[model samples]
Target: MAETPIFPAIGAPAPDFDMPASKGRQVSLAAMRGKPFILYFYPKASTPGCTTEACDFQEALGALGSTGLPVIGVSRDSMKAIDTFATRQNLDFPLASDATGAVTEAYGVWVEKTLYGRKYMGIERATFLIDADGRVAQVWRNVKVPGHVAEVMRAASAL
Candidate 1:
């Protein structure tokens, strides 16, 4: 019964958000100004596909970080869940908890999904590449986990 949110368009300012992140910190799009960053949304923390995507991003952290870009994973999971997932997966980047689903809604990743013929509302796997000035430079919707990080790296490196 949830209304789908309109996704931000490329070259437009990304939705600003400040959420509780793992490691006892807060991350905000505003704070990451003057540098490009990646904001990826996942359905949940510690799930199979989400885990693979997070780990892949973690593994590519060195290459991605070399571009002076920070990568953040967002989900509707609680801080405790995010913290535990990060610790268990050895994730070196930020994993933000969007418990209220507001951030996910704003990003337009909070969507309707169906599996096995049952429809439900959930966060869609999506990623936004925001440029240094806060504009969204790229977007990937319904993301497939494999080789995703590498693709993002290629686009980011070109930025």
Candidate 2:
């Protein structure tokens, strides 16, 4: 049996992590203190759903940033793959690589998934809204791509 990872709850400090991201830099929750940010976990890069979600976020970047929130996408893909995805999608936000899955585990987005009777461990689409104090303000699990970015933008705007 797999132990269930403990996800951070609302009003609790978010689990901190540092991972390699595109543009040849490391992104960390610690560095984002004093600013609200969005941390969204997706299963893979360049896939249809993921692409749509990413592009939606990209399109709303201006609006989302108007609330002074930075957005980040997390995946277990390699840094090279993340770079390509960012470039191909013209993504302006950082997409961090969690090849070791540690960050995903900490965020509690990594879990066992069954698709067509085949079971595997992978990222479950989830999003976390962290407040300027570094505490989680909101969370969405098993996210659907459509209208999701707009919803997040609304939530971030209210923060």
All models, RMSD in angstroms: 1.0, 0.9
What are the TM-scores, per candidate, against the unseen true structure? Answer: 0.97, 0.97
State the weakest 10-residue window (summed lDDT) of model 1: 1-10
lDDT of 1 by residue, 97-116 (tens): 99888898898998989999
Clashing pairs counted in every model: 0, 0
* lDDT to native, each model: 0.92, 0.93
lDDT of 2 by residue, 1-159 (tens): 467878899999999899999879789988999999999999999999999999999999998878898999999999999999999999999999998888899999999898999888899999999999999999999999899998998899889
Error of 2 at 117 (Å): 0.4
